[model samples]
Target: MIQMAKQYGRQSPTTPFLMVRCSAPATWCFFSGTNNYVWESFNNPTDTILPTQVMGLGGMLFSRLTQNNYSRGRFELHFSNEDVKLYLVSRPDDHYYRFEMFNATNASESASYQLVFNESAYINIVKRNGETVPLPLISWRQSTFAPNSNNYYRATLDFDGVFRQYAYPRMRSLIDGDDQSWSVVRYLPDNICNAFPDQYGGSGACGFNSYCRAKGGTPSCECPPGYTLMDPNNKFGGCKLEFPQGCGVLDDELKDPMESYDLANISGLNWPYGNYEVL
Candidate 1:
């Protein structure tokens, strides 16, 4: 399509802004810019990918700093190779997501494929010869309205490193003007706490000294008793010691070590990268 766009006359700058604003730009079959399609939004995607767009090999999606902050976040999904691995940049050496896209022994399946998500709420593997394999999603929400005409779909790599699919209805002229809302249709790694294993190079789901608890598919970071978060604004930010320890404080330990020290005995907590045998 890049080669074909070269043969067409040059397009005005406004033409791109208008076409890209369309609900389904793919259905319009309009190439954004005539400049060899170089300066196109599709070529440079932010966090969300619209329907009918394919995330080809080597493509990557970086999340926002926070849901409210649009700057680049610590989490990223780099489709670096065919296996389709996604690593949490907080721990670059470790990856949190993976899936094999091809079958080495299955001769019937095509090797060249594209990951496509359309009006449907799930992403699928489309082969060059029209063969397809539907990826497993937790659940397909029964559409409350006509999806193809009334709604638009998007898949986003969220701030906290969870991939979610959303549906937005065209509520330009709604009976209830306040009904404009984006509904979450699907999300990957349903259990956010389990995304990062117990044995870790970095903090598991939350930062060091912070407990990661899953509340309705979202990871909630909390400080255990006797400790406080480093930053109240940042929940995932590591926790800190409330006071100085080891007998070097104003409230010096006059008694013996055993008598002065009392263990917090917090349950369900583990050392992030501690070396300990299960035996």
Candidate 2:
């Protein structure tokens, strides 16, 4: 990660500005001072943010390529169309999944300027002069995570593009005297499917042809029969249909048109984007 930061076209970039690689998730860029710290936005933020920081105009948060890969992914968070929104980057010129701010319709001048996470844990859209504006519906939850006033906190865009808040509690240690420990306190959107629905070729949390189901408060993917996983190693990549595309040309007697397909019906499944179609 340090090597990648060095290659970012800056000469002799050192501490106070560092690229930290976590053992579990993706890499992160951090900027720290004597009493405060922040995630330095180099125009490319991968899957996270600190509560003390601000997401200003043109600043974007992107998810990782996969759960295991640290590179950039297809999800994005940015200010656009007179509001702050979350989108899925489909094509270079195409973006989907727009979750826009509800209360900033009259304040376009201040709405897209900067998003601030005040010390009170309120995520607000504000102007250059620090005038607070309304935020998106997803960020309206009350944050009751009251820790020590000196402790640090972070709001990260997770691997699946879930916006979450984490707290680092300050405590006195026997050897270190003063320290902080990390813990998650909040996550937004509530459902992964609401953020990543099947819009463009099953473009949700579980990819195409797969459904997102919550099991024990965690999202899991499942593909219908007659289809198999596209990448066995990456289960979230979705599945591929096993049947032939065009008409079968084989001359064998068992090659009947009806015999080549398998029939299975899903009962309780809710179709993506909306409900079932009318007959």
Candidate 3:
């Protein structure tokens, strides 16, 4: 980002701005004396957003490549119209989830809208008048979390493509042995497998050759027999065949294809995406 103290490029504004701030995820920003922000990070978002921040219309939240990797991933949440749509980037305009707003807006009126996940964990698309255009996300459930303590909260588009709100206890508070891990307050597209019934998208909730199953509001991906995870450290990264079987193989192996490649049964399994004929 270029910062010209006196001017921006060849053009100059009526009043020369004094400061610049970048409120970003992973990357941080700071400010002291209050003068309106000529630019702010809230307007521009990353994979996660704090509860108080708002994402304007046409804003998007992109998924990360993995839990530890910050590279851009394949999932996207687009706020463009009456619905907050989640799309698979590789599959183009086909959105897996369509969360409808509480109230519809008139096409003729000019209005500005912003999306926010309030302190209580309610995702709303609100108008300037404080009217909530509810995206019909799950209702806010009361939690025992104490912000005054070391509790922290954030809603993130996870690596596995599930958008979730998590509350973590930064420092231990309880005397008894308790699970102080980040707890999921809410998540959407409840059933990841059902979201990708048709095998067409590049990869559904999980990666290719892996299937998605909701395990406590999170998508748990697993590889089947004869296949192993591509990256064991990152299970959601998908899997690949353990043994290569093709024309490149020896003639003996090709001749006894049935003996070399035996059928393996996986009950109650749903493949993310594949040809219907193969099912």
Candidate 4:
């Protein structure tokens, strides 16, 4: 792809943008610029986050991923369950990037960015912070160019998952160049986890639990208390009893006998049985 870009004079300032389509699910794509800007797209969204873009909040930036096949990568960046926390996940690698927004309070906010494809591609996020600080910056350089106009670029992912670049062109309007220029588009493919429900533990959900599979979909049943994933084959198979022998056993030390006994305990306990084991 790099060779092609060079052939078209994409390396020069005359070309403002470049667009690349995916193998399938054409909803998402890659955009790049002569100035070293890059971004991914999902048709459009109520809010969007672009690649190699900075979103300031205590000197941080939010970065987007390139399309694996004409769609957003399965990996996602989200806030942690803890107060003002954040995390990045891709399949088994959950919380790949984690951090706290603030140590002082629980205040939260949400917004989106956009993907612009011209001579270059870039994802832009809205500025949420009003106070200015001397934030660190990074630069992404084109590694190679092909005759077909395909090019490769690289950027760094900060500890907070914010991206910074020093050489990329500033955000511009599809019609006019403006710092605040942006537009909301429909989301391509529409759903990010099209094939992996268990991984997401249901849409808009996060975290690792006995009922959530690191690979896909939500577990149908709850894991036995005090126990977590027991079978590696089926992550969402539900948790198993920590100690099978302890099932139905009551701790006599408890002051209340009835309260101390669990589902495993009862004088004439009738075990409800089924193919409860998920492989």
Q: Please say which candidate is ahead in TM-score: 1 or 4.
A: 1
- Tens digit of per-residue lDDT, candidate 2, span 1-279: 223235457765554544554332333446453323455343344576655556766667877767788777766777653555666566433333344443344555544567666666656777655666745554533345454565666776656656667777555567866555766666555665544434444356677777677532245778898788898866667789877664655654446668666668877667754545321
Q: Which stretches of candidate 2 lie over 4 Å from their true place?
A: 1-44, 91-112, 134-151, 171-183, 195-202, 215-218, 242-251, 272-279
lDDT by residue for model 4 over 1-279, one digit each (tens)? Answer: 332335455564344455676443333454545535365453332123333334333322233333122233223333222221123443434433233223323345433221122223332223235332221111112222111223322222322132322133234446754454222211111122232333333222221333322121111323446666655443322355565443334564425545545653324211223245333
> Can you list the residue pairs that collide in candidate 3?
none
RMSD of 2: 7.8
Q: What TM-score, over all chains together, does every model reach?
A: 0.71, 0.64, 0.72, 0.22
Candidate 1: stretches off by over 4 Å: 1-38, 103-111, 138-149, 172-178, 247-255, 258-261, 265-279
Please write out the lDDT profile of model 1 over residues 205-237, one tens digit for every residue. Answer: 667777877765678888877689887777766
lDDT of 3 by residue, 46-105 (tens): 798886677776789999888888899878988865667787888766877777653446
- lDDT to native, each model: 0.64, 0.60, 0.68, 0.32
User: Highest lDDT among the candidates is held by which one?
Assistant: 3
Model 1 has an lDDT value of 0.64
